[model samples]
Target: MPLFRSPTRCIPVALSVTLSLAVLSTTVAAQGVRTADPRASLKGGVKDAQQAIKHLELVSSTPKVEGWFNPRDLGDFGFANSDLAFQKHLVFQGGWHGWQAWDISDPKAPKRRAAVVCQGGQGDPSVYGNLLFVSVEDGGGRLDCGTQGVSDTVSAARFMGVRIFDISNLDAPKQIAAVQTCRGSHTHTLVTDPKDKANVYVYVQGTGGVRSPNELAGCVRSPDDTSTALFRIEVIKVPLASPQDAKVVNMPRIFADASGKVAGLWKGGDHGRGTQNSDRTDQCHDITAYPDIGLAAGACSGNGILLDISNPANPKRIDEVIDPNFAYWHSATFSNDGQTVLFTDEWGGGTQARCRATDKPEWGADAIFTLDVNRKLKPAGSYKLPAAQGSTENCVAHNGSLIPVPGRDIMAQAWYQGGISVFDFTNPAKPQEIAYFDRGPIDPSRITLAGFWSVYWYNGHLIGSEIARGLDIFTLQPSEFLSKNEIDAAKLITRDELNAQLQTKIVWPAHFSVARAYVDQLQRDKGLSESRISAVRGALDAAEQSSGGPRRTALTALATSLVQDVAASGDAVKVRLLSGVVRELAK
Candidate 1:
């Protein structure tokens, strides 16, 4: 399968970033600060609302397919869109019903390939080659993909776990396995062991209550029951040769202490005066596994944890941290280098207006931490949408992914009705917003529960999974904070598959645009002398116009000069990166 935009990716183009940046900067660690900023007050409607965008352009706005939604009640909880996963040119979108495979081969206009309708509140989906797994936690879920749900308190017809489907035939997928757990899977991470090829593992997070003994056979209602499905995560092993035999292999107590107390983490309570009461560290809401780095970040109820996953089936807790301002640790994202982690606090449960004029900036925001040589997480900084939203709008930090900008830690995040915010966290202590795209509320009279649940950068577009509206695709435009060279360089780093929670290493090819992106960064921050910057750009432009031999010779010379500038430049790390890219291009 050829790439979507590879035919002319290396062509010569204009690259400029000389404008002074007015980054959206503010100390997000402050509390009890408010102002009548009057944001999100534009015109509103279900489909036709005023949009506020900065350094971003919407390429397409696709609505839900026929029979998939009810227009009369757009905010219907039973039909809300959830998370997303990508493989090749297809995006599998999960919802309350089931999952839909979207053909983004032509990204401007996505087409629906196939659909599955199973009655579950959140069918969080993950894809690995021809295998597709959808989570089932709602008690109404059934074995068959039936629209009518099960009403019995305990019935044999109910299905509550992870469902594996053979999606080799997208037109008619077949259920391969239904691995049951004490509590159903709210979300699961697809993890691959570097040393194992015959099987893959899934770290299942069951946040819902446990099932009855009659329904699942191993679940109890008592909170103090030793066998209760809490304070631990279920690990399921799926053999590639026989996926039908997938079952629970281990339930590691990732939240236990040195003495092996299952409930060793924080109990539900407030920290001090005027603080919010946090939930106990019983079940994890989400887990992000970076197999390439042998580490995983767990966003448990009351604590943010780090796990050593050298053994995929048996992950051990290595470290944990807590934030006084965080009410509930909802999700986690790691930097590309695996040196830092960003955790989100889903305050107000992501449905209330947590970004109001009187709300504290540190309440429902992102807490960033840097990892030391000992793998301990130290507080770095915090970031929140530095804007006030209407009371009727539901806004807070939700799901987001790191944009593959070379030499920078940039992210495009979702904030419910507050909109999508793209920020730069290269300096974790001073994360700043670079771009954003927001829409007015669905209805101004009352809350509509319509906003972007998550936004991710895939191939070259920022695709968003909106709760009320359908899919939205956007491309980051060049501005003072970002350059065309940097955006093009990011596009060079493509992936065959993307399960955002299961992060993989990002590798850029030996391309001239990659080198230019680094050069543009130096110019933006004044890291190098003006004369040196001009000379480097001229050399790159000249080399790009010449043939193979001349281009190599010119690039080699430029690389030698870059190596010398590293000692004198203000940003030694960026200079080193630029020199490395130039050397790779010469080779």
Candidate 2:
């Protein structure tokens, strides 16, 4: 009498019904496994109606961390495909459809100031004061900034170079100059010369086809052409007083071999391993320059290089390393202390789901290395997104920057559709994820080449340049892993401007927030006993309240006791750091 038949039912009618259902279920299961439609095998349903079904939505630390999405819609332009630049209260969002200026004074409610309609390649932008530089490397780009596009290969209208703009007026950004190169500036790094205040330098790294001489003079495509710019990176000097006169000042052959020929560069081979083959080192994909230290880490096509940028105009390669696991050396990020560099490998070229369940964990991941006293790089280990993405997703390491968390080395990186993964790499040998933000696949049925291209921390907020979703702003929230005091300490470390490629050392003030950050870290690591932690906190609180002599005496006594305990516990590093803080308090 039941509405549906049960297998255990004694009725004859129920037994027949259950038998029929079991046969139907077996047939459906068999059909599903060997289905001809690829979409049928996908995680989500492939029907047009399933497109609206969201698998993963905005996931974060609630009110502590907030996000704002501004979809890309610059008339009829394409995807928002590259790096970002910040200046004052404005965030410049770049895309193939040109670029847009957003007023992020209120990160929660970002307002668009201006949107330029000029078509170009992946418009990777960098800002300095009132000057803004955008890289254009596609054949379709036009010199006139016209959307009509360029078809003739040798047309004078073709523009494949670094375009400089005077953004003094955000509403009307005027193109000041266009410095064309042999290839084109796929991405460029901004460098400042402390000795020379008159001009700044732009290391133009071209990673595309060589332009014809008819389009731009002095462009020789052949490697045999000794006069060609093919083997070297173009360095453009932009005069602060005369912005229009920005031109290529030097073409340093950093890749040249001992024989004076650019040999031994990656030659595109599997190197006898089952790993993906490396790309030929034609030009650098990205460069992270620490002007203060006069050092630069170049993520070339196949080689990861360390350069001496003492002379801003001519950077010389000091050390280079190759990894079998790396397919393409995509980008590099320096640790806050400058003792370590994390280089990313773009295994699938940012278009395929490299984080799939079957993909190797170390393929499209970050390679951490430590620098010895001689500036030689020593490989440590690797870190990748822990989440296994669906086949209909494009997930790989794209771009990221350090999250200035005082004593720790934490990074917020973009993993294409894998979303933003924040991890702690304080110990290069073992890196672990701390926080993350990801969305469902753009297409449930077919793979869609869309997601975050770059996620960088500028000032206080983590801004991400989404390829298809547009600009996304995120703020860190307090969790069991990260305390409010630590977040406050990170926010205290601010910058006047930020470019992900330009690495800067982060220094925190000797404030209570900083002391609490260290305390939080100690608690998380279980480095100190509960009683010791309480004593340390009590001493810090008392020292903050007291003034002059009393504060100094209390801090020094606490530091001496902590040092002795650390010595006994085999924690010399912690003792040194605590002693340094005590000295700061004394002053």
Candidate 3:
């Protein structure tokens, strides 16, 4: 659910009048009517209401882009907020009302498999094999999963923490354990050990208020109290063979200050040069763990820090950074190379229209950073949605994941009511939007606080969790910006399961598609002369058509010549990569 805030004052009569005008406009548009001047209808209204409606009816997209919207279940409450996890052809979507499992065997027409009704805010979920882990932070959550809700603060029926479920049978998921925490798990990251395959570790990041001592023993809220649990994150260890034994193994104070005061990190303040005031960093909002590289990035409230997770049980802070442009550190994503990190700022707590024309471009956007030779972070650049949204729409940079397009860093991101944006950031210094899908505000009369909560590329399609609408599926099509060969190359890289936070190195198969993808990128980036590119393409085509020894010899000769050309041009990276492809072709 969205962070609650006071409603804006408005006259009931004026709202009714505006709604009537909107209805009239929709009716007129439905009748295949066109006004003499389209801009005439948008002259005087409540902050571009007419223009917002026009955008809703006619959306912009790339050439062959197709999208499907799967509405929420009949009895779900509140808006959607959190990440999405996938297994095979199934998608698990979490909401404040509960979690739903959708069988996306036909992504164009997804069918709901199950709906589990459990009241929890920010029900972020992740899956591993047949196990599912959901974070529950709302105090109203009950142990029995009842709809009555909990009233007594100290009631034993109250349940807030991580809920584990056995999902072997999609139709009937059984709750196995509920690991309780001091602040309740707002979000959690799944970490696996290479040596210890017998168990999995979950780094629980809770951002809510602390539970009372009467409700949960030893939960102190005072910053002065060294024993306070508010400034630490919980690490839960779950035995693969016996998941019921899941329990908190460690509570590392990763936010501790120099004086050993865990609650004294990143005191909130404005950064003087008219920048936004920063939120106090008490706990992390999200953490992206690249276990393959033995590192993780934590997006704490006011600070972004890197961690050495060589020991999954006790992660140590390696470096920390602060940004004057960021108000709230919301989420983190790592580049495929693991050298760059992108952190999003949830300005206005994700409820206000921060993407309005008046908002600062860098305030609620992604701040890019690259690790120096010493493994310390250095500011690279920032990216925000280029399209301006109406004031009634709450838009800000939220959750997103990298699109595995072979040798590129492309991301499909969700920006609340700002709709979906797919952009290429391979050149971190100058990231640009390549494709987008946006609609008018959900309500023309006022703000509805609805849109995509998370959009991720899983399998071959882009799946998104819509806050008010439901599940959405999209596919990238060939356009001026993206080529068919590039799309095909991305499709070749598929996964059995996907969890956005757990970063994995993508390795495409050694096929002509992979080679062509690089060629397409080189053509787009203008890395080589057109005549040279044409010659290289001709050689590749001949090599692909030839058989056995002739094919190998042709590819080898072309590879050597291309390497020489690229080397002369001072592009050692491309030289080595093209050489490797030639070696594979020879094999």
Candidate 4:
């Protein structure tokens, strides 16, 4: 039987799922959705499964493109969908069998506009203007994007590292450049220096084993070797005017200690007998660069690092922290204001189930940290999927992006088969799950390595890269926790492009939605008195209905009244914010 319960329930794409990983063995099949939680015990299937959604609506679920998935096994690793990149009205979703471009102009019905067939394991991509950069780390990757794997121990035919494509024409993307690296680019982050607009920097994060010197000269790795490429990240400078000439510029040893030792970071091994054994901090699995604040949070193999990327070419490590509960530091996401950073731990490497009943909540979870003025990191708490899933589901904290909810630190994260969770982390010490959408399992009778690889918020909707299923798009629905005003405020913040690794600051305009969002937040948190809240809402409604002088006068009067309310309000900051937006609305 076909192995997939992904897009089967939704809309079917071209070509049926022909790949089969493992036949349904009665013993290895998913057992009962592990009904530890009474609220959710969804049935499982690769074609059709029971879904449990809350406060989020699935706008569309597109199946894998025809040629991309002749996946040999059930896990679908060879050609699984990877990370995502957005531009214009199209979403560039990376897949091992090259990447597919989906036109999301109408998110309700996303259409596959283009596909590039490049055989690689993890096709993480980032887009800047007309250039689309993809990470190629597969040993079989060819220079010409051929399906035939290169079997040479040392041959010029093999290509590894970052590939730059001119996506000026989406239907027919042309490869412009391929900058080879020592270990290949497992993932890369696009960074920028406010001082330099002529060029953008790509922080090449390679976690794969170092290539032989013959395969790629200058590539060396040894425990005692001083010139080893193991402990440093390669930075490629892509000139906007001439992206085809992009080349590796700096290989900063950000892990070095005060003694100038390149291998000064975590040396690997478990912190204690009960702790999760972690990998050594040699290379970064991923890096989230918030160029707006000159900060980048790197989830290195063994350490969660903070880098000062003021000089995009040469990032300097400002601080580093390690968690005993973490098995692997996989990815990071910074708060909108850069005051907080959340790092995910990919315990089972996104393959095995880590959200089982025996699993620890702290492991394979997201560790939240507060960044003080001195660049010091203080651990706040950790969050994992609240409900325990069955063993058949390979679930763990994978990839996610921040939801621009004005005053809140909310994130929409993918937990493999555990599903997509939207949580509020404004209070790092006490993070809470506000919304979630989870399907049972791929097979109720077998273990399958499939689910969301990465789910990110871009423009106004959440776009997810399902490992086996395909592209999934979702829109936030207003609930008690997330009000329509807040959702509207978030939608007001739009972007031309979005690369979760390279975060763009969310700036909401001076509109009535902004003021209403603040008002909703105030009422939700009991920040304002009910009498005052109703009065303010009435004033806002009157102002919104009027025009010109009448609206301005009404808004100004409300803003003045809010100044007096702030004295008695519990959440003065948000009240002040509401008043500020009200004043702006009047202007």
Query: Highest TM-score, which number?
Result: 1
Model 1 misplaced stretches (Cα beyond 4 Å): 1-26, 29-38
TM-score of 2: 0.86
lDDT (10s digit) by residue, model 3, range 1-587? 24442110001111242432233233222322122323212322222334322211121211111122124321134445356898899888887777888888887567777778776777889999989999988888887778688988688998889999999887789999999998898889999877789999999988888989988998998867888877788999999999999999999988876677786556877555555676677788789999888889998887888888889999987777776667778888998889888888888777778787666666688877788877787666678777767677878888899988877789989998887888877766677677776666766566666777888988878887777666677788777778888888888988888887788878877778777877777777777777877887898899999999999899889877877777554345665676677668867
Per-residue lDDT for 1-587 in model 1, tens only?
00011000000011111110011113464322334333546577777888888899999989987678877888777888888999999999998868899999887899999888877668888999889988888888888878788988888888888999999999998998998887888889999999999999998998788888988887776768777777788999999999999999999988877897788887877665655567788888889999999999988877889999999999998888776667788889999999989998888777777888788777788888888899987777778887778888888888999999999999999998989999998888788888988888888888877799899999999999988888999999999999999999988878889886899999888788898898899998999988999999999899889869898999899999889998999999999998998888888
Clashing pairs in 4: 4-46, 5-46, 5-47, 21-74, 29-445, 29-446, 30-444
Q: Best candidate, lDDT-wise? A: 1
Ten residues in a row with the worst lDDT in model 2? 1-10
lDDT of 1: 0.83
What's the TM-score of every candidate structure?
A: 0.94, 0.86, 0.88, 0.93
Candidates 1 and 2: which is better by lDDT? 1
**Candidate order (TM-score):** 1, 4, 3, 2
Candidate 1 positional error at 323, Å = 0.8
Candidate 1 lDDT at 268 equals: 74
Pairs clashing in candidate 3?
none
The residue pairs in collision within model 1 are: none
Instruction: State the lDDT of candidate 2 residue by residue for 91-206, as single tens digits.
Output: 88777778888888877677778777666677889999989899888778888889788877588888888999898888788998998887887788988888899998999988
Clashes of each: 0, 0, 0, 7
